[model samples]
Target: MTWTDATLEDLVLLQRGFDITKAEQRDGQIPVISSSGVQSYHNVAKVKGPGVIVGRKGSVGTVYYCETDYWPHDTTLWSKDLKGNDAKFVAYFLRTLNLDRFDTGNSNPTLNRNHIHGQPIKKPDLPTQQRIASILSAYDDLIENNRRRITLLEQAARLLYREWFVHLRFPGHETAKIVDGLPEGWTHCSFAQMAQYLNGFAFKPRHLGENGLPIVKIPELKAGILEKTPRYEGSEVPDKYLLNDGDLIFSWSGTLAVDFWNSGAAYLNQHLFKVTPSVGFSAAFLLVAIRECMPVFMGKAVGATMKHIRRSALDEVMHLLPQGHILADFNHRASELYDQVQLLRAQNQKLTRARDLLLPRLMDGRIPV
Candidate 1:
């Protein structure tokens, strides 16, 4: 195996992506690669498969490796030419470059191709690059497998929830009587009746720090973990604003979503509600109930700029309360599945940390392949 020293521009051609508006985006399987990974799916692909993308604007230096054909959004710079370099190897190499340091903008960080083009880079021969990528991809493949398993487990649990609650086909349902389109003892009640929504605190920008309590925002809620959220260093942070693992959080403002806070201790930011289920209502039940209400909440959301769900909307949302024994049974069964999901998520976090630590070292030849 051999290596050669060269500039980035010599190894690949970087071209700005095309502008695709949200209105024009049709739903399909082709990923829409933005500055921060796949943002959405589009029917048409702007770039071919086995491509590498670099964040040129908002999320500067972020790199993505797409195995399938994708539509790279205008906010990114996609590789128009690899110049015979291994695509996956290029992705890894870019990560080792610390492209963030090449930001050309002061206020809003941005990456300019011309600036990065001149930077020196070390490249290994095709076979050696393949070997390095294979080692790293093995970890990625395992992570992906775990993710699929987690999704399946979650789906199975959700299916059981629907079968028992939505379809009214629980154990011994043959003798159960129905009234008002519900099981004999089941009652339709407002969300407020079953759960208490502790709205997050408003933390000012000045109070934020590099090291402190992670802020759980809407994005964090969507991702089921905190990523790139700001942190706050305040001993005065009220107990109500602090979060715990397994806590059910609902993003009531922008992009309404219900998720478990599997990530460790964090501060709950405004527009999010840390929901605590009342007696007889299990966290599992609350999660499903809130998820069922998402469509209705989204429909009622109002905003000229960014749509948001109001507290009033959540207050009006209804849940079908099951009998005590039935709710307990469901919680007992689903809790195991939820625990597995959390375990898998935690495992992925660890795998990610290990892979990330190995990435730069392997790419820079600090750790041999």
Candidate 2:
């Protein structure tokens, strides 16, 4: 296959996205795409899909591909003309440009469409483009499938938790008597009593390095997966700050969330807590308990801009503790479900690494399609 050098403007049309405020957005199926990805959903769509979206501001140079009709926000630029080019291939090709370098402003990073339109890029003929896209897309499809499976497994486990604990409908519930809206053997207890929250070490910026331990931050917790985490020098990292797989970590500041640390050995950063279950509780139970208490925690969080939960919040949050036998049974069942999620997540991490390694090689013709 032969490749030709061509400018992006020669192959496609770039147009600014529409503006839609949060107040105007209504709940629906159509995704409202921003520079970072889908910000929300709306009932209406301005652009039809299989379309490619490029970040124009804020998160400059980021690229997103939507397979369904979507609403592109003003912070992005979407393709208006493919000119017989493969849409999937265009998406892959865009990533190779490292578009972030073309930032037009000094302070607020921005991508000027005019600059990117004229930028030179090398691409193969349509058939080869499609072939390359197909190969790379296969990996993404597998990753997406694993994500769906993980969601289903989590849902089933959460439903079981609600049935056995919340609804007081455990296996032998028929024989148990209800008192004060609680199952006969269950007792109310504070979260602090069931688990211990270890705050992360405060590492200065100068302490970070290009190699050694990766630092898990609020962004990692929100994504539910860790990638491109900044590294900290091993010598500077304390023993207590190190993390292990399946450990539950909660972000107390900025977007409160709870997730298991599936990513291999890393250091927990400040504003996060490495939650360790006490003798009577399990990681699975603690995860659900923290998730259920999120609304209350959010309400109590104090801050004008970035809300933060105080240490006192943990003491105030309450949970119903089941008897040892019942709790053990619940843990046994939920642990199996959570273990599967961790396995799937680990598989996705490998798949992502493989895809990233292959993307540039495939795009540059180092790996022929």
Worst 10 residues of 2 by lDDT: 220-229
Find the candidate with the highest TM-score and give its number: 2
lDDT of 1 by residue, 190-309 (tens): 888888898898888787878888888988877645446788887868887899888999888867888898888988999889999888777877787678667877888999888887
* Clashes per candidate (backbone, < 3 Å): 0, 0
lDDT of model number 1: 0.85
lDDT of 2 by residue, 1-369 (tens): 879998898667778999999999988999999999998999999988989999999999888888899998999999998888888988888887888899997898988999878878786899998999999999999999999999998898888888987887888899888888777878988888988899998989897777787788988776643446678875766799999888899999998999899878888999999999999678987887788778989989999999999999888978777778999998888889999999999999899889999999999899987
- Model 2 clashing residue pairs (backbone): none
Candidate 2 TM-score versus the reference = 0.95
| Backbone clashes in model 2 | 0
